[model samples]
Target: MSSQARRRSRGTLYLALCGLVLACLGFGAALWAQDHTTWFKRLRGGNAWSLTYQGDAVGGQGSALTIRYRFNPDSFKPAHRIEQLGRTHLPWSVHALVNTGEVARVEVEPEGHTVATCRILLDDVRVVAEGKSPAPGRPAVCDVTTSSTPEKWPR
Candidate 1:
């Protein structure tokens, strides 16, 4: 082809490339905006719920051996145990925010005369579900399905 024709073809290709880049950028921005909106969050999970995991040394001094918990049921992976070198002190608590309709669970194993407790709370006040160690020196397991709550969502 002639040099003039080649120049024109290159110009068209450059323009097309610029348009494609602009289109991709616009699409990415739209998706990012949608994801940050409330409606998208509600559709994915609804609202954020609160969870608490606690342990107390009841009789003699007690320490927690391991604490296993899940904040999201879909992934269903227990968090890593406390990384402290020695046993973690009792009467300790952990708090987390999870998505609505997800299962909140906590399991605590106490060494010595300690008790483990787990509670799922709404708005940091209403107790959705709670469980304490059956007895001292035993593991306490607590689980609550967020969908079980009678209260409306997006509250």
Candidate 2:
């Protein structure tokens, strides 16, 4: 190619690259803004419930568990309950009423493996008691705890 043509081609490539980078950054900023807005709304709404657990290795690997319950602001009924375990990234959520009581129990049992249990005590909107039991046959036990209130939650 001629020198002038090559220079034009390089300039076009650089412009395209810059455009792509700016597009990505703009998209990322938009996502971040949306997340921050949603979080702030939830905090202001004051109707979020959560349970976090760390359990022993059930099968061959350690267990990472999270239980989240979102309640309706007007009715105080659970809008959704999400439970996650292990490394599986499944969107497993159930719409049900999770009674607000002194204790909440969550258990996970991988097929053919012993059960890992988390017992949490609820004090109004805070978790007052948290405990975990290892899988039936496993000697390693996992400890579970709840995050602080929304106002105190880390950003």
lDDT of each: 0.64, 0.42
Lowest-scoring 10 consecutive residues by lDDT in candidate 1?
76-85
Q: Once model 1 is optimally superposed onto the true structure by TM-score, how far is the C-alpha of residue 45 displaced, in angstroms?
A: 5.5
Q: Put down candidate 1 lDDT per residue, 1-155, tens digits, no spaces.
A: 99999999999999999999999999999998966676554555435465665555555456788776665433233232322223677666767755556666767788746676656666667776677788876887777666533245543
| lDDT at 49, model 2 | 38
Residue pairs in candidate 2 whose N, alpha carbon or C atoms collide under 3 angstroms: none
TM-scores for the candidates: 0.53, 0.28
Residue 134's lDDT in candidate 2: 44
* Candidate 1 positional error at 43, Å: 3.3
User: What tens digits encode model 2's per-residue C-alpha lDDT throughout 43-154?
Assistant: 4554443533323333345333433333333324434344444532222223322322212334443323443433333333444433333445332222232232332432
Query: How far out, in Å, is residue 85 in model 2?
Result: 49
